[model samples]
Target: MSTAPSVTDRPRRGRRPAAQLVGIALAYFMVLLDTTVLAVAEPSIMISLHTGVAGVGWATTAYTTALASALVLGGGLADRLGAYPVFVVGVVGFGAASVACALSPALAYLLVFRALLGLFAAAIIPSSLALIAALYPDPGARGRAISAWAAISGAAMAAGPVVGGWLIAVDDWHAVFVINAPTALAVLVLCRTPITTTRRLRALSWLPHLGLAATLTTGTLAITRAGHRSWPEAVLFGLVALGLAYGTAAVDRTSSAPLVPASLRRDRAVWTAFAWGAAVNYALTTVLFSVPLLLHATATAAGATLLPMTLLVALNPPATGRLVAAHGPLRPIRMGFVAFPVGLALVAAGTAAHGRPLVLGLGLLLCGLGVSWTLPALVGFAVQHAAPDAAGSVGGILNATRQAGATVAAAVAGAVLTQDRGSGTAAVPFLIAAAVCALGLAGATTRHLSRTKEAPVADHVAEARHLGHMSRTSDGSSGELPGD
Candidate 1:
């Protein structure tokens, strides 16, 4: 087994450890919170703006598609320009967009502003991980830090409904967005710190990324429209989406500046991780988005109602981190997949049988367990293998895929949810989502998770190299960390 570095091998830092780490986590928390919070508010927004489910679906997809589109480019920009500038700009832009969303008078305006929110969020999500790598350069320190980071940020995915419920009860749909302004302000103030990371000009192919955005946007339009009895138009949009997706891939293959390097694209582990992350998000978002509409309860009531599930999601990551650390990610990851399918199935059964809250609550509890188990392990699995100076890009790729899953899941939920299906039950989407989560189980059982067996210490030196330290040598010299 590999051993921990000695005290002398550790960095001599001029750092505010708590402040810097907390600030970095806060940035991610803000970004993640937006994605889930909107779900609970969707029904209320549809009512307030006099819009249908399709309208709200468009708004939701606009935000996620833009985020998924821009994340790779955002990471590249962070590598080229510097993470600090990119992150700050994203935060400011996100704040402005959130306020704009609050002021939107119509669904059309809300959709545009939500897309703007996503564009800025792309900048925040990927770059934020690099900031964590910068703050905690030691391998063990970095891993633990990332665990906490994932815990906090992951909690947002489950906490959105809880938070949004209270906000909706107090005000209207506007409060759902308006609340972000102060949160964004807090992030800006808290995250102002100094660290340095290596910056090299990264060749970025803008066209492919733009094409990706277009593809998802069109696809979202198609899916959302299809369920609303607009098959002809949806078919037209679907054709355009396929064309755009193919074009983006073609360009990526040929472009000197591909969004993702061809090598990473070809790596089995990388693709597996990306796909699994997408599946995970799809299941979670599907549940979050659909449940509120199904419940027909007040926003606060719905949020409180989901606490059986969300509470576990909010609370379980620390233990998950420890479990993964001791047993490797495979066990927890498997546990998650098991819980996901069972939970989803129970929810489906409960809902189909006429809204049995007890069965539903058990299902929700398992859903939370699944998420809390799965996500941290996925993150640990990916970051443990990154190349030095590629932390932002690696983090970006993982998160972008996760967000992609989240976006499409929301669109799919909206697609199936356009009907006046009464309340407290929608068996079809939940069952489909369950099947998808089951696939995640089979998909993740590759050599990637099993690779820990090849090396007991599990890339300790590689991790240290990946997230470089700011430390004194024998002569008492030191340097700054990366991703400033």
Candidate 2:
């Protein structure tokens, strides 16, 4: 087995560690801000580009599909090339793509640029997580840093709609894309400090990556096409997606260095984290999409209406971090699962009750609280349990699942709404989202109770043994130490 350089062994540059953390968080913030900003600007974009509803939806789908598909590769690249360099390149590429998007004269050009944006976003997400894991070796400090990162994402979600709406009103839809340039540039400036490099792993086969991309793209298209009542097209796409999934699995089982390592695939905690992350985004995005439709509000009004919920989302993470520090990750995560579904049920009830703003707002408040509490815990747990050398890969899997959840949200919401455009139909999507949350809650509860029953060190040691076995099975290698 090849011994990689440890993070502690690397030399530090002149910048303070705090500054490095902030720079990484800011980079993540740009991505989050772009997502919410686009949500608000979709209608304006449709109008400006003279496109139909389907075309407008593609703008979002293209980016998300590309992002989900490319994530594992990004993780692999980060682990090989060093997270700092990968992150820097991603930010620069993202900025250029954003500028291209702003300048696009046609809808096709816009779509192309948006896909490029996703490619870069895929790179940024995993690299940032890997860099954090490397920088803060202490578990407590790392948990807090991850929490802060989650908090910044929440802040971006809160700000995006309001900011995007105002920008659209003042200038045009292009202004939303234009804003990312300076933000990315600023992050680039802050992250000038040198980062320690690690030895690159042997090149993995690209077949799994290709299959993953096909699966994501076809799966998303199938669902969205079904929403539009294009049954034949949907069926064809669904078949293709299924075939790709099978092919990917086959490749994973045979490859010496799979995109998702065997050790990670065997960890229940990692899967639990992935599921919860996906469920949280599924519920959140469902509400974010449905409420706007249910109210039939203008972009500005929609932004205003959503403000209270997102503000809570932004503000709650620091306190949640303190909770994690004191009580451990499971408590807040469990709480989030319960609250998320309850919040969705309330939203469904509110929509059924003729769109009462107060009722809707109350539901949204719970949703925000749920997301704020759960997100940090989910990230912290995943990183903590993962093999230290594979931080970027683990991060990739986690974020890929989350992005897939978002894609599912878009497809499900689109289908439900297209079938029944009435305000009352909003309840159906929320109820579906609630079901997804309940499944996540069940998974979390099982893991939490199981952990409670075992001595913590015993559990860790068992997991280590399992990882060791997995590594040996994969390629006659020993496992790296589990990260705290």
lDDT of each: 0.70, 0.71
Q: Give the per-residue lDDT digits (tens) of candidate 2, residues 1-484.
A: 1234433335243456677778877887788788777777767776789875456566776777778778777766766677788899999999999999999888999989998998898888767766776677676676677656555544676787798778888778899999999989888777788666453554646777678777877887898889888999999999999998998988877876577776777777777787887788778777766676566667778788777667767677666655666666677788888888888888888777774878777888888888877876666667667766556466557667776777778777867776776656768899999999899888887745456432254444333222211110000011122233
Q: How far is candidate 1 from the true structure (C-alpha RMSD, Å)?
A: 7.3
lDDT of 1 by residue, 1-484 (tens): 0112121222222357666667666766776677667778878998989997667777777887887788778766777766778888988898899999999989889999999988888787657766777667776787677666656665665677789888888888898888778877887777666555546655767898899888888888887777776999989999999999899989888886676665566666656766777777788877877887777788887887677777776667667766665666667778999999999887776666655889988998898888778776666565545443443345556666776787788888787877655443377678788888888888767565565442243443333332211110000001112333
Compared with the true structure, the alpha-carbon lDDT of candidate 1 equals 0.70
For candidate 2, the per-residue lDDT at 438 reads 92
Off by more than 4 A, model 1 = 1-17, 135-155, 192-196, 353-355, 382-393, 422-425, 445-484
Clashing pairs in 2: none
Off by over 4 Å in 2: 1-9, 15-22, 129-154, 193-196, 266-269, 324-328, 349-355, 380-393, 445-484
Q: In TM-score terms, which candidate is top? A: 1
Per-candidate TM vs. native?
Answer: 0.84, 0.83
Candidate 1 TM-score over all chains jointly: 0.84
Question: With candidate 1 superimposed using the best TM-score fit, by how many Å does residue 109's alpha carbon deviate from the native?
Answer: 0.7
